[model samples]
Target: MTEKTYPKVGGRSAKITLVLLVIVYIFNFVDRQILSVLAEDIKADLN
Candidate 1:
């Protein structure tokens, strides 16, 4: 019989992935905030 082993979760690749995810989340948050702040202005302009 043979056994297989897997690498741990907190490796370099995992850290890089986490950092990228955080950056994406930050951008998403900023985009939503900007939209919320300009919602009334946008609606007014459209109408």
Candidate 2:
């Protein structure tokens, strides 16, 4: 006898997930860029 799995998880299409991930990534990149731009000034003052 073979066992069968029941009850599927709520599914989202791959495309939608990819789109959301990309948007979040872009926001993260923008934040990182701003920090990167200011990094030198902060470092110079810390030491």
Candidate 3:
């Protein structure tokens, strides 16, 4: 087992993960909004 005095995180993986999550959230919101807008049309067509 090797013990390190200090840990390095030059990769900034956390930042990358946050950015991707934000992007996916935005996409989900846009998709949900579009579906909501079309709800009236769908209801009318069903009857």
Candidate 4:
């Protein structure tokens, strides 16, 4: 049988990845909120 090794958690790469994910999530949330707030105005303009 062979043993498989996995990368360590909380490493530098992991921290960087986590930070990037959080940033993307924040931007996505803001974008959705803005669209929701302006939906009515956008619809009225388009119609």
Q: What is the TM-score of each candidate against the true structure?
A: 0.74, 0.51, 0.63, 0.77
Superposition error at 13 for model 1 (Å): 0.9
Clashing pairs in 3: none
Please provide, for model 3 over 1-47, each residue's C-alpha lDDT reduced to its tens digit, 9 standing for 90 to 100.
Answer: 89868777646788899899999999999999999999999999999
Q: Give Cα-based local distance difference scores for all models.
A: 0.96, 0.91, 0.92, 0.96
Which candidate gets the maximum TM-score versus the true structure? 4
Runs in model 1 lying further than 4 Å from the true structure: 1-7
What does candidate 1's lDDT look like per residue over 1-47, in tens digits? 89999877688898999999999999999999999999999999999
Summed backbone clashes in each candidate are 0, 0, 0, 0
- Please give the ranking of all candidate structures by lDDT, highest first, separated by commas: 4, 1, 3, 2
What candidate 3 gets wrong by more than 4 Å, as runs, is 1-11
For model 2, the stretches where C-alpha displacement exceeds 4 angstroms are: 1-12, 40-47
Per-residue lDDT, model 3, residue 46, is: 95
Residue-level lDDT of model 4, residues 1-47, one tens digit each, is: 99999977688888999999999999999999999999999999999
Please say which candidate is ahead in TM-score: 1 or 3. 1
Candidate 1 accuracy as TM-score:
0.74
lDDT of 2 by residue, 1-47 (tens): 99999987546786788889999999999999999999999899999
- Report the lDDT of model 3 for residue 34: 97
